[model samples]
Target: MTSLVKVLNENTIYNSEKLSNFIKYLEEKYIIKDEVIFFNQLVNFSQNNSIPLHGWFKYREGYSHTLVREMITRFTIDTKKEFIVDPFCGAGTTLVEAAVNNLDSMGVDVNPMSVAVTNAKTNSYSKADIEEVKLLIEEIPSIDLDQTEIIDYEDIQQYFSEDNFRALLAIKEFVNNISKPSVKELFFSGFLSIIEDSSDRKRDGNGLKKSLSKVTSVIDFYCDKMKLLMADISESSFCNIGKGYFGSATQLDKYVHEFSEEINKKPGLIVFSPPYANSFDYFESYKMELRMGDFIPRLGVKGLSDLRRLAIRSFVSAAKDPIEVDEIIDLMAIEIEEAIPLKETYTGKKDSRTRKVPQMIRGYFHDMGKVLEKCGKVLESGHKCCIVVDQSSYLGKIVPTDLFLAYLGEQVGFNVKEIIICRKAKTSGQQLQKYPYLAESLRESIVVLEKK
Candidate 1:
């Protein structure tokens, strides 16, 4: 009759009795009020098998797999449905978990890189297929090209070595040659994951800095990175399990509408973590992938046109009302105004470009609103949609994301049921804020809405 925690700590095989004791222990220690029994079962299962989507791409800011499992458990108890949808499915965490639970699920993301990663993780693939791809990847011959002509401006060459870059380029060429869409996607994902590692960019460093600036030889950097990536893939060949799509959430409505006629039922749950109001450029962070994929027109240049087009599309389709649109505009304007002084302080003239924050925010919400409207339509009545979001404070003003989402949900004919606060680690800048309240306040909240 050893304690469950002790047994778990000792790495002993858990039986029914030991698992029950663990559930009781969790309830006593953490005050888990709902689905304790289910959670125990899930934890036991997780011990045996790697969590599906959680293993895909390792993002420093990625959501916890444990948290996702808990959310899924809660979702199952609240509704009796078979399908879940994550409109902003970063790395396909939700979809992978849903599939593991034996529920059909759909995930959508605007970032092509994220979509590629998601698709690779969720899609069912045989070990033979993976081995074949691995063999093909190894067969690629490394060829060195003159660094000056091939590498673009703003290219983070430090992230990869010359030899590694040639190896990576060879692999990229082979992946592009693959005929099957599914296999191509898997290869591309693995390629994308290694890009940062292969480059001179310090992959292990904090993301806030331009760590890639220090590296000089891109080819050798990429080669080293890919070799490591290939090793990881070779070791963990069994866990990948989800599919991904390259499209905007705003555009997904049309896709769903077309498919809806074939199916009478709506999704049981729709969960997502959309981009925050903080104005971090997702495109900028993964510019390397866009460069490799040839999605961006030119290397090292920010695609302002692409950004503007996406914003316009999202705004046009997602805005529920004039007020929501206005709110987005106002937020964007503030961000634009704030950027002026920041540009003035920086030595780079390029930093002085007009801040697109205003446009980006407006476009984000407008698209999100449209996505919510579509979700309201596709979600079955009484089913739940949970969004993990955070209020972002910029220039000493707080963006009330939770409040805004609640309002948007009401406009789309859903009732905001609850807002569960989840504490977040404060950034250093936030910690230095003069106002103690601002420094210590909750940043994230799970907004739960029900389609009526």
Candidate 2:
């Protein structure tokens, strides 16, 4: 498998056909493009950037509302789809949008911040509720952040100015005084919405960047957030139909059994966009928000270590053991390491944050395979699962993630219904810089599978 390949700015290195062979194997099930959908059908941040409550907080990898709506219409019969479960429901697009259309839905995620945001987004709000929040805003008092413990980490402190920190404290302290659970969650979400404005920490898709530029007041940002939130809520119906849980996606079926009423049937459609295998960790991205809410350390989700443990291997690995997956996947990972050699890929490169690309790649499909098995247990016969995902790559080795998941679905008693080409994904400049030999970007597709 060893063959000499030219590496940019580095010595001529050994490359393996492992990646090529892996893609070739996947070609057995990988359906070439049949047709193209509109740009809005693709899962992206742009489509969601201007949308109401959907735009509240940026879960950078979260898909747009139109994707969910389109999926719901296509899979359901006359809007009679009884249940939808999203194991990796970031921002609760599936659950929130489902409730808007008056459908039953459940959402799950390992990240506490994402779960809380989704829970608040899907919560039913009314005119009275909005008024209650506004009144609380006026009544709430600002506390001296010097005396209060809003954020305690030094790494996080690098992102906040003293004034920004104090202003954020006032808003969070206000949220703490609210007694209503629903209103509390809503206000807490509103508080989170303004974090980007309060801090110089600009959240790019893959990483956080520190900016020295001046930002707006926390109160002003929160006020703007509330106005848009109230507008979104005003048009939103109080369905009481959607529910979200703070749990791991790997155990989604367990949550289904524990939370479901006797009358609630198995899900008719299991639709979600799991985070890509790219090195984007939600827990790291929202550290400021999570620290403010006290959802980390001893209080929330688990600790930072445990959150990474529960999360799909999307980014850098901790000292934890590698997750067990299919032998083929493991072998491919081994071959990837042998072929490109992770260390060699970044010999002269400045950004060398990919020591564990093999594991993240293996761990992603590994956890997703388990997710499919768990989801398979709860889906009715003939029910469909629609997974929106983009292709994942490491070094020059691109993994056909959607196709691999489709094959894994077949192994767990589901037939590949079809793979729909949504749109060609926009390659990041970082990706281009990272893998110079790779010629093209991959496609983002919806892999449709049905229980046999």
Candidate 3:
């Protein structure tokens, strides 16, 4: 059998035709359609800018609350099941929406900050709970810096002005003194929410970079956030039946089973946007929050590595090695492996990041395969699992992520319902400059699957 590399060398036409044929096969078999009208505005976090609890913290990778509500209504119309689950509930958009509609929900994420944020948003707050945080905010101005026990973590000091840093420490000290568990979690989340804005560095592409503006008022930001949170809670019309767990999505079956037993209802619908295999690490993006909030106890490279190992291997840093997959996916991974090195030869530079793309692709699918299998088990039969994912491009060769996951779902006891194309995805600027044709291949889609 000829390798894809050899085929690319001897006959470029054959290689292109093979990929095109596979893509066409997947599309025809899956019943895909362009449904941008339904999902164009609902596929991202931009729509949550004004939606009360969701707007308190910005998570660029999360989908909209409107999307979850739409899916819950559309998928559960014929059923009596009133429960929801999000395995990769980044900031808990699905869980929050579920609670607002008086539905029971469960969310799980590997990132502690994500769990913290989700818990704060989904927990029911009594009028006294609201008043407790209000008092904490009132007392923020009078706290003394000298009495605060501030343990400065590594590399955290440079991001803030000295006075702002001390002010933040004072607030953390006050919030820590709050004895009630729920109120403590809520205020701690509020503290974490203001860290990015209070710092001189802002979250950029893969990590943090220095912002143009310097030295934001940490106390001011905290007060405003608390006010907004209080108002949202006061106007909340229903009790919170949502809970977040600090754990990996790969172990979702365990949590889902326990939740089902406790609530006496299996989840009717599952909706989430998993981490994209675009080499972007959430740990790198949330370093400030993790460190300052004491969410991650480990201190150096070893600690960071431990956390990455627990997460789904979607980026080069987290992906350790390649694993065997089905023939359809194996072919796509091999093409990526063959294409990346040729790109290096053309530019006369060995880019380590570009070279690791193949490994990331293999590991990403392997982890997601486990997650989808669990979703099939815990969800009530005949319900829908909606995943919002975007395709990735490497040197103009597109990785059809939606198709790959759809195929994986079939192997794990799910019937592919439809692939809704949300919108065209823009490839990285560097990849587009090198391969102008990539624009036609990249897109974001919602892969809808129903349990068999």
TM-scores of all models? 0.69, 0.86, 0.92
Error of 2 at 393 (Å): 2.0
Summed over model 2, clashes come to 0
- Of models 1 and 3, which has the larger lDDT? 3
In order, candidate lDDTs are: 0.57, 0.72, 0.79
Q: What lDDT is obtained when candidate 1 is compared to the true structure? A: 0.57
Off by more than 4 A, model 3? 1-19, 41-46, 77-80, 212-216
Cα lDDT tens digits for candidate 3, 1-452: 12223323443322456665776677767887777666765556447869888887888777777777877777763234557889999888988888877788999998888889999888888888888878877876677877755465645777777777777888888788999998888888888888887887889999889984343666777787888887887788456478888889899999988887887777788888898888888898888788888776644676567678889888887665558777766677678778767778898899889778878888889899999999998866788899989888776667778988998999999999998777777777887787655555577888999999
Winner of 1 and 2 under TM-score: 2
Tens-place lDDT per residue, model 1, 352-418, is: 2234444545656676788788888877788888877776544433345665676678789888777
Alpha-carbon RMSD of each model: 12.1, 5.0, 4.1
lDDT of 3 at 408: 96
